[model samples]
Target chain A: MSAPVSGGDRLSAVRAGMAADGIDALVLRPSPDFRFLGGRGDGFLVVTMDGAAETADPRPYLPPGVRRVGVDPEMRVRELFGLAVDAELVPAAQVLAPLRLRKEPYEVAMVERAALAADSVLACAPELSWFGATERAMATRLRVLALEAGCEEVLSVRVTAGPGTAAPGSAPSDRVINPGDALLVSLSARWDGYCAEVARVFAVAEPPEDYDAVYSVVVAARHAGMAAARPGVPAAAVAAAVAQAVDDSGYGRFAAPGAGRGVGLGSDEGPRLRADDDTPLEAGMVLCLEPAIYVPDLFGARVADIVACTESGPRPLTTAPSSLPVLER
Target chain B: MSAPVSGGDRLSAVRAGMAADGIDALVLRPSPDFRFLGGRGDGFLVVTMDGAAETADPRPYLPPGVRRVGVDPEMRVRELFGLAVDAELVPAAQVLAPLRLRKEPYEVAMVERAALAADSVLACAPELSWFGATERAMATRLRVLALEAGCEEVLSVRVTAGPGTAAPGSAPSDRVINPGDALLVSLSARWDGYCAEVARVFAVAEPPEDYDAVYSVVVAARHAGMAAARPGVPAAAVAAAVAQAVDDSGYGRFAAPGAGRGVGLGSDEGPRLRADDDTPLEAGMVLCLEPAIYVPDLFGARVADIVACTESGPRPLTTAPSSLPVLER
Candidate 1:
């Protein structure tokens, strides 16, 4: 059984965040953010900025002094009204988003576990494959493996084959693998509430020279992006490094500009590794590196892995070998 | 394969909501609401309020004025940048909640299929009650039954026996069922995206008189709750009617107040059947009436079914016989 974290610790973390941000109170929307701060289960929690407040003390769970502004007009405002009598139930969208963008230690630990679980699933991939396996069968095996390895849920399992390789977010179908077909598998598993994403390419038969040449370039580009991850490093710099690597290898035209983003409690959050992103990487943040090059009507290749950011540099959390595609007869 | 609904028709429904609400735009968070409007996989959607003006030069497959918000802090603000952008990107929580609280014609069809799937599983419950049969074995068999009956997923299959009865929400374990022990089965199955929930009580041998008496009261209470579900009725009224039935039957001390809520696309939705809930019931809403009474150290009895409201009265969606406890010898 997993060591369930206490509700008190979660409440403390929310209080600490409110104090640091100087916000009078925090209104948690009904999402993963609420689950992260208010333990596991569905219900809303309003935390006051003050630390020394009891659950019965209605004064602490809302904006310190505001009296009228209700959070989202559409949300069940009456629920909040029942909890606290005095304070204004303000729109949490404006109050909660900025505070959630940053990460804390407990949040980082959850992300690390999510990544490790994804890595373990990928490491056991070879045993999961067989000839003439349908996309759904492969996905089922992966899901069962992830669950047995302690993952709370398999958020998504993408197994795309045949000529439809350009789309990254395609679902698994009944198609069977044939020789020379490129198989791209992307699996995301959740540990506790945090999510980890990883993708790998496989060859149905001996891969052609062109496929190997392209695979080498994509791998290099992924490492180039990983190297740029550091504390205070601009998100744009990482995107640029990956794009430049692909461009120099003559695959820029086919390469999707940005690779991936920061993975945490949600599948995608904070400091997205894209051209337009300017969020700076901070120590203890977790990120996913996915570089893709699509050739319409032919095939595409994408390699992704989750890594942790330390004061020293980026540390890869996934241990699946990234040298070449796993070719099956 | 499920027939994909036309994206254009879905977008029109969202646009109509925006016009009716007098809102400049709508921000859809990641959930069924985003899926219903965007027709895309998991992501956020921002739809502009202007209809004809925005539709004049519509994008090809993309909905007119519907912007796919990328992951960026400014993306939220940029989505509302021009044309009445000052109107906050308020969360679209209630739009789906109320709409989903009541079942649409198509949604009711899907939920009926899901409920039948649950019934089919219960039909085979006798075969699964062999000597030394573990909870996991029973759960696995029930899941297979649901899947074969065309359920996309078995959301939850809970079987509690002996000591497992004390703790709620526990997964199936390896504990073998012996003769003369009570078994409580709760299951929720999904067909397409819609879901239905059902629960039943079973005895390994002939149950005591008290068990049958308590079970009858629970079934009567469930029927009372279903009868109270009609257009313009408050949710609290339905809850109180159910609780009052149990209380009048001399089991008021064991009444657990609220029983269940609206069940449709998601297993749980709006107009919660709680004591404090005063949400007015609207026609086209489907709700699960589960009136349960738990007597500590003795027994717990519950009978649940899904019902949809019409202009005249409520219609039962699930056709499970809500009678005395099933004696499985």
Candidate 2:
């Protein structure tokens, strides 16, 4: 089984959750929540107080006089309409989300594998022929490498060079990479259904103006975030730790809102490392600690790595380079 | 603009649709419906009769007293719960599905580009070193080639060899391609937002037993389906034509349920070429005429191609070989 809960046990857990929430039945499509409950293939999984089963038509699995139904959040509107049953539909996340907050041992390993595959792509970046390639082409190469590294699916690959890095979540463009340009390459890939993310910064030929200083600050912030992730600590504390580091460096305003997020079946999940969230850290919780600083139209720096919160401390799933690597011409 | 409808026009069309459907507002995430309405990036789009805009939080855009809301079919349950709107939620497809049945000129062009790219990948299949490669490896190669050919996204790549093809929708696996095995490769890719699909069958150094006959029947069925697809013809008629061709060859029982489906913004859309769908095939509508015969535990043959219903006749976007192409040792 891929998760700690499987078969009858998984159904029992879901049923317990449903009863507590007063939900009559839980209807799930093929999504992270479904996978977390040990669901396989493209079918609807229906969980009632008495039984649980996967079917092409969930109506049959649902109770005859079902009053309320918790539907998959990822469900398409078209499918919701097809349900046709006269039941008040609610988001299944009410009961399922809390259950998925903590990762299982099997899930943690899957995340580590995905993280290592993504990290390996960055480890080989220096040897790639990147001098004259466009950001899109370079991103494509990295994706190919990620696939070759045994990633079952490559979610997204972002390659931003020079000014492009200043824009948050900038997509790969046709802009050619030039010497002295600051390149930020971030990759999110899935291995065996679990997702992990890794992002690293590099200078085309040499570090651009203020890049080294900014890069150092981002790295320090990532370290702080990692240190603050531990059992019993509030998720906001991790964000605060990252904020404090960037604030100390006087680049506080440039620090992004989300310091990191829980990662596993879904790239972004609960325990969001934001100032407003207070979800406590728990053992077996895997997270992508990304602290980024964008300085307007100028160059920016970001470093992301996966970490698993445990009783002992934070166990880093991916290794972040201590210093920025410059791709020599 | 990538689509025929631009800012004001797209919103106007959506507003018109909402008014007709008695929907006070529409909430769309990053989905095919969002793309069809010319939405970009990861943002929520809220459309009302009076105004339309994209935002991070859609609640502000929704009318305070709104009683009915149409949500994106692909919206997640979490997002659905977060909507917090006291309205009867419905699928937006009711209004949007019919509008998307016919493709605009620009949309058709994009679909054609995606089809050609997928076709090119199959065209070069003979040159690929597939003798010792696994089905998954070949699928990966096809995906990489699709990306190189400027496909913004590859929906899926199916590389089923030998008995695996008999299992419908069989995913690429680790099974090695042998000398006498039959290989089926299908690629669905999106170019500039529009999607198209292409599937072709091939023989190894030597054809498998009874493979040629089954493949010939499939080809004839595809031809019949294509010939039946025209302006003013019912979609079901086309499906019937494909069924008749397979039935004449005593392979009716083995024929897949869906002969094909409309291809464009969404990989699979309305005007479904099935016995149950009587939607008229209008000019400018693109269809993927796929006919297949799967003999349990033995072998199967499937040939899929894109055909656009023109004023005069069917315009094939993808070229399916008249006969199976044999990959030499």
Candidate 3:
């Protein structure tokens, strides 16, 4: 379901932004900004007043005696030093981040496609043999499922089981799944250059004592966040809503750092669902609303799904499970 | 064959190098430098004169009145601007690259394990069904094999077939692998935080016209590169030797840029095999010697293998095929 991208339109918008920012030039390496500007490969993209050029080196294409140049946020310090250019350097995000924050129709479609792919993998999790399988093995199985689901790239596959779920952001290990254990499976993938993430918590055979209660609170928090996502709303409000739900449930201390952030060309971008970020959500903004709770050394529950802000309301991309899935023993 | 790494020794060495370079502190994100120093997660590592500290926010760890701070080469400019530090910024590679060039005994073992995993995947290529298979399908298969072989991460899996091979650095696509097509398969993987790469070329059913002639030249160039890698030899000499072999074979124009590069914590690192790099090859330095020739509109041949430079000579880490293997139709 790869849609045709209008690179010309994006380039024009970026150039217009550059003019407004009074940026003389942009030197980008292989990054989200470079890709959005229609450049590929591990090379340099030099955007000047005249036009843009992709090259192995940016020095020659850079405007002679350029006053101010915007550099890619992803550009390495080694490459930054190697530029050997004399100019005031600024983050290219000044000109590109705003343009990137709001996804166009095609970009949204790509993200939806990626979300569907990730959703399909999670949907098939119940059919897989989870009992006696190590977390690493299950992670590998999920990765294979992602590739089979036509993911252009599998960014990350996380499988945390039993007590492993208590540790946030834990990589899959060789710990075997046992009966009545809590399991968390998350997959972030790219489909046709757009990125999306989906995560679901599960139980083996039966839910561990108290896991369902925590899991329900997590689900309620996710709903609160999504309900708060609307055009013209401050992104922080969505974060606050999620936090409020967890706090009302008396699990305030167990809440994760913040609600999920925006997802598109980059997994984590602008309009972050955090208390500190006040970027107003606009129509066409896609956010991954994930609210999680980790009861240290016991269990944790996290559910992530993508949604697009619209005039009417938030439209869900990846289908979040209505309740925790219980796998066969 | 995961070996225990003594991170303390490496940290002390980096500190000494920082002192020599007049760097008051180093702030590294999640990159090769950070991994080498034993920091985990997507946090910042601040190495000051007092000690090293890992935290989500690096602002608090900065030594008071820091003058010159070194940053990770792989750090993004966006993060750089976020630092808001009042000091001259420099690439940390100035102090880290020189020290990272030479691998310790445990690092070598980790690299060797990664190399073997990649090699095992390529070794099984001939036995797999290739007739009429799409390049993307083959790539997926290789990815699965890499994961099954215990790769912690699969960096890249390239499958170029027929005329597709003529285009260098082409991502796997839906093009069918016809009989008599030349195929190039490469896999780079990480094992226990160390990285290595292996690639091999194959003839499907039978060899394409002039393919063997080009393939042999590529093999000879790989040999030339490995043979020239020894203690006290300049990295440029290895590139020169590889170029000489292909040039002497009358396919000079088809030769790829450079010979190969150092492989360890990062798949692509320092002591690059290029005419511009003058770093000497030390006994413990590991390199991936890849040589290729892409004949326009016909086919291409690329063979990559990892080798560890030793006092005696070059020790092969990943075994390069002795001859081109032809697959069944």
Candidate 4:
């Protein structure tokens, strides 16, 4: 689903952000900012009072005497811009993140489409169990489904299935599924230029009591967080809601990290739903509300869904069968 | 193939790099440096004379240091590390690239295994053409093959097919193959912790003469670059040698941007073979030498192989049949 991007509107929004920071020029890479500004190629975009121009590298061609703001804090990018060692460089995020945090109609549609693709991939989880497939193989199939569902990029497709539990951030390995194990499939899909992420937990058979306990707490936290995602509320309120549910279950320690995050051009966007941040919620922002818990080497379970914040409430963009069937062979 | 990592050796190398830069403490993220320093985490890493510690955020945990150096010049990371706004954070690559550039024996084996996995997948390319699979479907199968071979991670597997040519950096899309269209499958697979990359071209039917011409030039450059690899040689020497061959063919301009990169714990690593970089080659270092040419909006062809440097010369780690017959219906 492609939208005809109007260059002037997107450029104006960026200029507004730059003006807020008292800057005159914005240098952008092939990030969502560049796409929003009507870039079709995978190159650098220089937006200044002189107007927007696409260039191979912006450093050599930056118009003289323009106060520039940019992203990607890598020294190499700094070198490309010929930024002197002491020259003050403003982060483009300061200018673009606000513009990006508010989703345009096209971005909302793309995020919704991304959620649909992720849900469609999980629809085949039962068959995945039937194949008695390895985690890596199942992950590969998800990649195909994600692409077919209109995902322009699959940043990561994580499938954790097998006997023992892997730590939260570990990559999928050559682990085979067993009868009483759980499956955790997480897909980070990009549609057009926006991003959407969804995660689900599956059971091959009746899982252990520990798994069932963790799943119950996780699902409760997920619901609580989604319920708190209303306009005019604080993002930390969402995190607190989820945390309260997990703590009430006496598994509070396991919920220290990975509560959830905003979903957009960057998978990990602004307004991270953590215990300490108080970024305000706004209408038209997309988010992946995830509540996860890990029992170290025993087992882990979590569920995530893409939700869009509107004036009415938090509307989930994707649907999973509310009652997950016991996926026994 | 896994290696028993003695934390002492890795720490020593990192410490030595810091000493060369006259810094006592090194702050690292979940990069190759973190892994080399015996971290099994995907988070921030801090190593000092006092010892090493892993934290969710390095900023809070960074001790009132003796002396500190770091890479990520990004404001966020700098803020996390608690460096002053004007703090001179050393580029981590400058310190770590030299260490990562020299592959330990186990690291070399992992790189070799990654290359083998990629080549093994391509060996079935003829079968893939017989199935007349779409590029998206072929990419999924390649992912499975890669993991089955030895890849603990599929960093990126890009498959470009159908009509017009896309730049080297474009993501794989859901386009079906046509009778005369060409397929370019590029993979970056991670084994153990090391990375290896390989790419090959396939034709559904007899391709146009122009496609064949670009393919000839690309393959010649690939061969020339691989032959130029040897201990004690400068990386720029390799790039220059490859450029000469491509220019001689009169199709050099089409080879802009991506000419391939180093393969290690990260898909793109150090000792970059470019005309200006003068990093010296050392034995045990692994590389992916790719020479490509693209005729915009028409077609493109390129071949990449993983090669290792040795005292004698370059050792090819991936074996595509000396002649890759066009995959046809």
Which candidate number would show the highest TM-score if scored against the true structure? 2
| Residue A120 lDDT in candidate 4 | 77
Instruction: Report the Cα lDDT for residue B87, model 1.
Output: 27
* lDDT tens digits, residue span A275-329, model 2: 9999988887888999999999998789999999877999999867788899987
Tens-place lDDT digits, model 4, residues B1-329? 22223456767766777777876566666666667777786666777656778776655444464454655322242243244423445666666666677777778788888788777877777776533566667776677677656577777887887554446666666677777776687888777777788888766677655677677777788888888988888888888878888889998787754455678887888778888778778887788888777778777777888889887889989744444357767
User: Which order, best to worst by TM-score?
Assistant: 2, 3, 4, 1
Residue A278, candidate 2: Cα error in Å is 3.7
Indicate the TM-score of model 3: 0.91
lDDT of 3 at B322: 70
Instruction: Name the candidate, 1 or 2, with the larger DockQ value.
Output: 2
- Candidate 3 C-alpha lDDT tens digits along A69-139: 99998887788888988898989988888878888788889999999999999999989999998999999
**lDDT tens digits, residues B1-329, model 3?**
11223566777778888899889999999888899898887889999877899988898889889999999988877788889999999888888877778888889999999999899889998789999889999999999889888898899999999898989898998999989899999999999799999989999989988888888899899988999998888999999999999999999999999999999899999889999999888888899999999888988899999999887999998767677789985
Model 1, span B1-329: residue lDDT tens: 11223445555655565566554454443345554454344334556544322121122223344433211121222132222322233335534444445555777788888887787777677766545788877776676566556677788988766545535556777888766666778789888777899877776665644777877888888888889998888898899989999998998987776878987766877779988889888777788888887776666666678888777888887644555545465
Candidate 1: residue pairs that collide: A70-A90, A70-A91, A71-A90, A71-A91, B102-B285, B103-B284
- Model 4 reaches what TM-score against the true structure? 0.79
In terms of lDDT, which candidate is strongest? 3
Please give the DockQ score of every candidate, comma-separated.
0.13, 0.59, 0.66, 0.15
Instruction: Name the regions of candidate 2 deviating beyond 4 angstroms.
Output: A1-10, B1-15
Candidate 2: global Cα-lDDT? 0.88
